[model samples]
Target: MSPSFCVCRVRVSTGHCTRCARCASSASRCTRLPDPELERGVRAAHVLRRLGSDFVVFAEPHLKASNMKNLLQKDEKKEEPEQTVPCDHKTASRCLLNLMPVVSETVSGTLLNGTFLPDICLEVVHDRELSKLPFAKSNLTVVLFADISGDAIFCIWKADDKSTLADTIQTVVDCSLNIQKNYGEWPTCIGVTLRVKIGIATGMLEYHFFNDDFDNVHYSASGTVVEYVRNAEMLCTAGDIILTTEAWNFLEQKGVHTRYTYTALPEDMVKVLCFDPSVTEEEKVSFTSAFAGVRPALYALNFEDAPLLKRFISPVVVNIKTQEELIFLSEMRHVTIVFICMPEFIDIDLATLSQLYRIISAALKETDGVLNKVITFDKGCSFLAVFGLPGYKGKNETCNALMCCNKLVHEISAMNM
Candidate 1:
């Protein structure tokens, strides 16, 4: 007769088996040889041990993968060539371009594909005050700021010499039109309508780098020019592209031919540009063809090298061990938003900043809060955290958020001493 196998949770180590209390009575009679079903059950038990009951839902997949090898073979067979679907090359390019900020390497391919924005770095002085920086250079730049349904912010800027003013104007016009037309049709946005608001500004920008970490250094820019674009972006309605007077004048001066029609916003101060419903295909081709050969440089931030950046955006990334957390949190629920700002944090020494980050990270972890976003300015830094995600239905999220904030204040204050 085949040896009886125990279906209870088992922990195997050093050629010995430790059984849970529930199965201890049958431990002496259980078989210990390899069995696919037994192995799958063991894996699920281990997953539950490591990730807690919250991940019990994900364990089902591990249990079902008892025949993973055969499943992989079936998947390989499905990869055989089949009839292809026609796709829009331009729309594909735009989609890839939109992801440039998140996936750094794609920036090169995106630039090579079309007349996109040029490469430019906004420098921030690290571990030092900008007022004391001895050397700085000012460049006339056109900055473009895009807000995607309040989910993410994309900022791109180019110096005047990188490309002609006509090319810049044409590029933004093309961008605005593409977003308005194809954004909702994309696979990720198919069921939802995402609003894309754009703001453009042209002004003098001052930038410089710091010597904090030579191996992984980043630069930042200063000047009211950034604020101008940010304000213009905030004033924008869905599908609206607001341009500052300076930016508008640059296009007017360059005599750029665009199919967009401009109208002064009903307010006394802002200028708005909208797609022209009556634009002829001939006119679109006429303006778009002028920059047919344009290839602007694309310099994107390397997120892999930035540990702080990774930590701040950790909630959005899924981990194999705790992927269920993300899956469970991906729904709408009431959450307490916590915004923390460190004014003049740019001048803080790297050592102190590292300590502060650790303190805040520990506090948030203790309180079960999630960091949603982070932004670094020339003189300051701010981060957004949320509590009471969908998965934690029983926990008092507001209490957790308040506790986290209280701990941050105490810890940060002690650190400053």
Candidate 2:
């Protein structure tokens, strides 16, 4: 079973309450007492009935139905601004100046501390300019993490396909450099000092999407490679592509080293090497093997056939309808983050999964919450929701988060699947 929990200041388990002082205050709001055996029986019956009938018919109508809007709460407060407040772009930029570093430290503390297998991973760092780039494809899996103000995007390429790992690495590098070069040419970006940090690491990852609806697709990756590449990107300097030792070694082994010019970093600065003993001796043999590197500009990089890369770029930017929306996302504000995990979600049917996504998205929209990120792995899926961000009903963030979670739990339970 998934360990259901809520995060205010700290994690508070909703299913099994420890009743510690910190979580005790919110205990009543967080806890959900559902009979597991009964839930399983009902869910099994529902699945069996749907399987007996044409489930597609049931799923299709609900997906296109206008009644999904009715699921949202009607009585939203009118006082809050419907649009993002106008602020100097410079001021907005400063609000997020310290954002990336803080995000990197948190990721390091949580996900990157584990040991794992090495595989090639690439990152493209960009400001809002590269938002619409199609980076997802069949062989590539995109995982998105929303760090309140921005997203931490990672793309992992599956090795089972015909394309060589070298192809994956080079393509990502080429595309990233191309993006940076284009941004450099933009008149507004010339003196602004905006930089994109693309990090590449070689490590293990796994992913699969529930359906073909790419717009509604919630694709994510799991395992060490995701963490490794994320850390690599976060540690990277602006305007440079950083590579973990594993990625570097893989490239050299493939004899693709001559294509790009790269300088190795000092041993102390090579963070991937310091991780648990997964680092092989040969991978550490050369000082010039792994580090920040520059590549020749490829102005005409095309995405016509790169579906995996397209997936990588999808969730990084979505649903931004205005410049005000962009500015709003840039502002730093205290918000409550609610993380929802369904450990046994792998057993749920794809139709149900899609339905769940829509339900959650609509719930957050109605409650003045932002559905920040959705992470799917082999066993289950998790969602990140934020409350009290600008351009929404800004009052009572913590209360809103709890109420939304509670509502979701009940609504999802009623789905009985």
Candidate 3:
């Protein structure tokens, strides 16, 4: 028999059961108590009969009452509401919903301690001349940093009259892809959005550097320049580049002629006006001097290296071919020295050899010598040095190399030059 069906003894006294209301209403005798061992059987039979009656009650229309209570509990949970997440331009523009994988990959490796986005925004603004009147362009470069979920939006004016907004965005996408291909690995999570906002303004390039830490700093642009750009973007329609009156006036003063309406503010409305002629002049001189100095040095480096030279130089001021030729011509008057060292072959001291290698390496670095070759053999002969490289700015790499090479040459000349 099943464990639940095991039989047990039960005693019943009908005379005593009729005196108790609970027992009298029952069909079975209920007044007699069995021994503790047999009580289990009595309770089981009573429970079965009560359950049968309960089952019948549950089958009636009132069964829905329990179900309705559960549903009401569920409804209360539903009515409790959910929290909304804050949105940002970065998330809004380049989210997976508008995923542009190529753009994301392009800016992924940019070193941003929170400053790359702002710089990129300024670059886009500068490139498009958004500060100019009638703003004629509506292109933007969006840079998103995944770690901080921060975004930077840059708008360009007058990219192409024939292109649609989508085409302009695609152009930015293509540019970003090219950047990634040329510059090595970028952050996989970094994203880009294009042509999302149009901005135009005319103002001085105000500079500020944000200190991420003692070792990290990022440059930013702000002041009236930022405000006007944001205002212009707000006033602009989708795919339209807009400019503020201040930006238009600034462009006019800069000799940029454009037809655009302007609204003059009351003199009292102006809050701040500060000018620094020294700063502007300093910036002009610095840029001019840097280009003047670097151009000549770059030309010389390219000229001496020729076919093997392309890898080391950057493409600026001219195309690779012209730059190479210019550098080659500049090397016509330059001289190159090669130093090779040979130590004694007798005892063959490995410690001395290691020390000598370290010395040569340090001399090369100190002299700014780009070590082009190193060849050593079993005879204790070492060939090391550089050729056709720029002098170290102040590190004295050339002098250091010459001094070290001379010492080694004097020591080894008796054995072998």
User: Which one is best on TM-score?
Assistant: 1
Pairing residues by index, what is the TM-score of model 1? Answer: 0.44
Give the Å shift of residue 252 in candidate 3: 5.7
lDDT of 3 by residue, 1-417 (tens): 000101111111211111111110121122222222112222222222221111001100110100111111122323323222211222212212211122111111121001112223233333433223111212221211001012122322223222232333223222222222322122232242222223444333233322111121122222344444555444433223334554334344644222222233342111111122332321110111221121121112222222222111111011112122211111111213444535343232333433444444454444444333222322233443442222221233345556656654544443331
TM-score of each: 0.44, 0.39, 0.20
Residue lDDT tens for model 2, 1-417: 323746663322111111110110111111221222222212221221221110101100001110111112231543543332222334222222322222221111211110000112112211122243222323332221111012122333344432355565544444444433433122222243333455665544443333223343343345556555666666665455667676666567777655565677763123222212332321111112111111001111223312332332212222222222222222223457787888877444445555776778777766776654555543366776666543443567678788888788888777766
Q: Where is model 2 more than 4 Å wrong at Cα?
A: 7-76, 80-85, 90-137, 140-164, 167-250, 256-335, 342-355, 362-368, 377-380, 388-391, 394-397, 410-417
Each prediction's whole-model lDDT (CA): 0.39, 0.37, 0.26
Question: So what's the TM-score on candidate 2?
Answer: 0.39
Please list the residue runs of candidate 3 whose C-alpha ends up more than 4 Å from where it truly belongs after superposition: 1-152, 155-196, 210-214, 250-417
Clashes of 2: 13
Q: What is the lDDT of residue 206 in candidate 3?
A: 32
lDDT of 3: 0.26
Between prediction 2 and prediction 3, which has the larger lDDT? 2
The deviation in Å at residue 181 for candidate 2 is 16
